[model samples]
Target: MKIHMLAAATLAMLAAAGVHAAPPEQAPHARVLQLDSNSDGVIDRTEAAASTRLAARFDALDANGDGRLQREELRGARKGHGPRGGHRGGHRHAGIDALARLDTDGDGRISRGELEAANAAREARAGADPKRAARTGHRARPDLLAQFDAIDRNRDSLLSRGELRSWSEAQRPQREAEMQRRFDERFSAADLNGDGRLSRVEVDEKMPRIASRFAWLDENGDGVLERNELRPQRGR
Candidate 1:
């Protein structure tokens, strides 16, 4: 009787402590799938490469062959690049900060050479191991900064709606498809209410951190998000 009682007490204690557990790291099929994906932390290269084309196109517009571009070079890129009907005040610059600063050589014109250099640097780093993407306790590297600057359309430190729309429009179809796939995958789980749409309420309840993270990424203020938009915000 004593042995049986002791066993019962032990079971009770274990139950109270909730200690007989290795976490349910793998549960349902959907949960495991989400874990596999977010864990990889792979930035889609095809999408990144497609964005480079916009930089290239912008460089082509800077007639003087200098190595930096300004708002003037963005003649047809939404309001001549002056805010692009974008908002960049009260502690934020609408999505164009990097473009204004893309003058790698400080030549005041984003030339073909600058575009090539930026693209080369981006490709080199992107080709490295995913483990290296986030160096230990360090901030973004120069090449990453160059990548952001290369896409800043209004020459502002921030990206505006116009710039993002412009970039999306310029991307190759295949890259666009791949990026959209990743985006859909990332958001699929959190949309738990199963309404075939995402709501701020649902996102806040199921994925609050992602909701906060989305503010910087959703430059266009659209409900749907994209990786290109998120890339610039990774610094935040």
Candidate 2:
């Protein structure tokens, strides 16, 4: 259950992009349902593989790297360095509330048409009274429509709960791989002594973000990052 530096870095990137001011939380019940596919009370490698989110961080969550995640390990994954480190409870609830609003038909799913309608409503409101809209926080994000289209995988103009989950699952591996490649490049460049691990000074100079959370990543309090500590586990 050691802190996963790459995950933190990814969250940082999302914040920088203004996707959300804080990490979005996954509701505990939803998490169990999504990750524990078999309902066996635990997430094994096979189950985790079915989820892009879980699969990407499977290694880190499997504290012992035993190819399975017990309840304890799952709990650890939720623990993070600071307010912005882990998912924020308010954000999670807000997302659920937003989705509920978008599912106008109460079918528990959102269609592109419905989403567009909602966006239009928000836009109209904003145009009529910009100050009121701003004060009420009802303005729509310009990219929201594009984002909805991207997640509608079947091009059926509808976004079912399953479709949304599938889109995320599909994107997880590519994202994680790209992050891993970047981390490797950075680690190699920062390893001044050509050693596999990085000392505090090396991290301070080369990876300021990681350095800021050094205590969290140094799992053993050894003041250095073992090669494995900075890299994703193989085959993940």
Candidate 3:
């Protein structure tokens, strides 16, 4: 029930925003990781301050008393697992907030009936000001709006959850391949010394974010970042 609710809430928000889920590699903890501005693969106290809720529970989530949040620590926190196995309720991941917006009767939950009504409301608004709606809808990724008509299989002129999910799944492989190709190009460009790895100095000069977390990403403490080190950290 909890998973389904979250999924529906997320889908509704995505449909309204006219954006789709990010690639799989970027989904898990991607929003939290974005706070790692230094890109060292963990969220420090300063970075945690970006989210007010996360900042308040930082110490409790810092299981090792390191004063920073590793990915697992955050994952545990989101799942309501505290350091002592207590439930840390209300870890914000946008689901509750999304529900609040869509739950028209303030019943604290969104039913299929409610969702359908909300969809109709959105379509009416879009009809009233299509040019303005188009501009607001795809603010996350303007490119998605270009493909909107094609993805709207029902021709209702509104993106339903199924259509968007199907489109995103279908585009996953191509998106991942393109991401890898771009990463390879950037890595080659950053490896100025023709080496297979990036020295601290090279990363600092070429990639400021990696430079901030250079020591951490250098898993072997070899004072450099290898190609694998630069890739997204999955299941961290």
Question: Candidates' TM-scores?
Answer: 0.29, 0.37, 0.42
List of clashing residue pairs for candidate 3: 40-213
lDDT of 2 at 176: 57
lDDT of each: 0.42, 0.57, 0.58
Q: How close is candidate 2 to the true structure, as a TM-score?
A: 0.37
Ranked by lDDT, the better of candidates 1 and 2 is 2
Q: Give the per-residue lDDT digits (tens) of candidate 2, residues 180-233.
A: 564566678778898888999987776554566567667788889875665433
TM-score order of candidates, best first? 3, 2, 1
- For candidate 2, the per-residue lDDT at 138 reads 46
**Cα-lDDT of candidate 1:** 0.42
Q: How far out, in Å, is residue 23 in model 3?
A: 37
Give a tens-digit lDDT track for model 3, residues 136-204: 331222323556676678786555545555565466455546646756776787799988999978876
lDDT of 1 by residue, 1-236 (tens): 99999999999999998878776665332321232222333212212222332232332332222222223333322333333223323112222333444456674555445556655664566557445445321122233234445557767654344554355335435443554565556456656756555566765664444565555545688774444553322111
RMSD of each candidate relative to the true structure: 16.6, 19.2, 19.5
What lDDT is reached at residue 20 by model 1?
Answer: 83
